[model samples]
Target: MNHINEALKHAEEEKKTRSMMSSGKLRSTLEEIKTEGNKAFSSQKLDEAIESFTKGIEVYKDNQEVVKLEKCTDLTKIAISLFTNRALCYSKQRRDANVIADTTYVIENLSRKNVKAYYR
Candidate 1:
């Protein structure tokens, strides 16, 4: 039973990896960086978290590294979530305007694609 469970878990993870890989993007790695950013933030390591978050955003913004999902609805959502998380980090520094700025960036990017508008 234990072996079967482990195999099942591995298979699920592999399927996710395959999906990400087949998408022809650095979204997976960027997401990993975002995760690291969150972990760093949790540990009160602001500088490390900001670096990781910036790296993730850079990867996401790279033209050649874009996900081929055409519509990219999901990716946009992920981007917004990351931006929101970054906003929270900025908020910790009592930079409310910075939070609003990051939120505005997320909103503008989504709207630029003519996707749905989400008020931050």
Candidate 2:
């Protein structure tokens, strides 16, 4: 029973990934979210900025299952940006743990040479 349930879950995940890949809206959506987050950050709305960045990160992570199936360097780059920007917001809020988690993700998964991430 567990095996069958696991197979069904995998099939469902694959179906969602294929649908998201076919839509082709992920890039534009992520860009919009990033822009909104930047605007919020510029306005010194740390909480709002964090919300936007977190939303962007969640969107990217949701579709990440298809990343291996289809190479999209742009998406990865945007995801990295989202994490970095969110880390900045966390820093401003004095949320050291959140900042560390986001920056660590960037350093480990995206760019080991990201000096800012290392510094954060």
Candidate 3:
């Protein structure tokens, strides 16, 4: 009984530490990447905007790997937004297939409340 209790206590402490570290650093980094993508889009720099969004997507994938290893749920709003923004850029560039692929990924894997994906 004592051994079981000790193991459970250690697991709880590890879970707390993982949650803290993941939320703080990962959220800020993702936010910065998303901001950069939005800024490029607003400036009418389509290529740069796409590049920024792509970087955000890459970071999002890395985040997912970490979340999986840590056995936690990742809040994926920003990641979905990154895909949506990339789709918008593709639409502007007349890349219909790419736009479709991105929007489909968001709609299928993320939230139904992402109305932007529907319109895209």
Candidate 4:
């Protein structure tokens, strides 16, 4: 009985460690996507930038459960940036509705105090 309990505890610890590792990996991946989007945006590639940002947002949304479980503010900030940057791209393209939708999402869901979102 004692040995069985010890084995169970070990398994639980292993599971937790794996979860943490995966969380870190996801964060890194998100950061990379954000960087790529920024680069594209800086180069005046609105379409490419929008594509990268959208992909990042989708990836973040897909792993929201893990993000919430980890309680990482960094992930939330990255997500907010993705939306805000994409909104900027939409604005450049004169996509008023798309800009409004993205900014509204940031204002309504991510950060109510996001000045760029409010201004856009």
Candidate 5:
């Protein structure tokens, strides 16, 4: 019974640690994903770029990361950029509805004044 309690406590601690995300690490991960997406975009690999950007968006949406940030505005701005870039990819693919949806997401969630979102 004593050993089981200790194991349970250790598992809980591990779960807590895994759920704690630092803002710096979160930013770094987002940037790395964005860079990969950018590379794909530059190579004219629209689909791959969209996939990478979508992954970046998912990372940005992680609750742990959002809770860790002191000011979530930075993340929101980054999300706007990512969505706008994805909209560009959709445009290249002639996926007009997707482009509109992505841009609208940025406009609604990030900022109405975002130039890229407006342009999209």
Candidate 6:
């Protein structure tokens, strides 16, 4: 019984340790990606910006820390920025399909305030 209990505790501790490590790594990568995306956007590299933002989003998509309701606000902001950049790029290239798709995604995911502010 003692050995069994010890084994269980060790297993649980290992599980928690792994979870914590992954959480921290996910957060760090997300921040890095966001910063890179912003830099790319400022440099007029729209496609690269989109790639960075999308990769960051994918990393956080299933994280419990990222899934919290409070984090949605920031997530929405990222989504809006990415989609807006993509839309603008499409507009410049005269790609109506991409522009509509990106615009629709931003409107659906972002807050009404953001939608109104961006459109205006």
Error at 87, model 5, angstroms = 0.4
lDDT of 6 by residue, 1-120 (tens): 999999999999777555642544555666677788879878888778767867765665545444353454555565556556556655656877877776775566555555532562
- Each prediction's whole-model lDDT (CA): 0.67, 0.87, 0.82, 0.88, 0.83, 0.63
Question: Mind giving the per-residue lDDT tens digits that candidate 1 earns over 1-120?
Answer: 999999999999777555443333455676787899999999998778877887776666653224544656566666665677777777788887877777778767654442322333
N/CA/C clash count, model 2: 0
lDDT of 1 at 21: 36
Find the candidate with the highest TM-score and give its number. 2
**Each candidate's TM vs. the true structure?**
0.64, 0.83, 0.74, 0.80, 0.79, 0.54
Q: Is candidate 3 or candidate 5 better by TM-score?
A: 5
lDDT of 4 at 108: 87
Clashing pairs in 5: none
Q: Total backbone clashes of model 6?
A: 0
lDDT of 4 by residue, 1-120 (tens): 999999999999777656543677778988999999999999999999999999999988877777787888888899999999999999999999999999999888888998989987
Ranking by TM-score: 2, 4, 5, 3, 1, 6
lDDT of 3 by residue, 27-63 (tens): 7787888889899999999999999999988877756
lDDT of 6: 0.63
Where model 1 places Cα greater than 4 Å from the true spot, the runs are: 1-24, 64-69, 111-120
Best by lDDT: 4
Using lDDT as the measure, name the better of candidate 2 and candidate 4.
4
Query: Candidate 2, residue 23: CA error in Å?
Result: 7.4
Better of 2 and 5 by lDDT: 2
- Candidate 6 local Cα displacement, residue 103, angstroms: 2.0
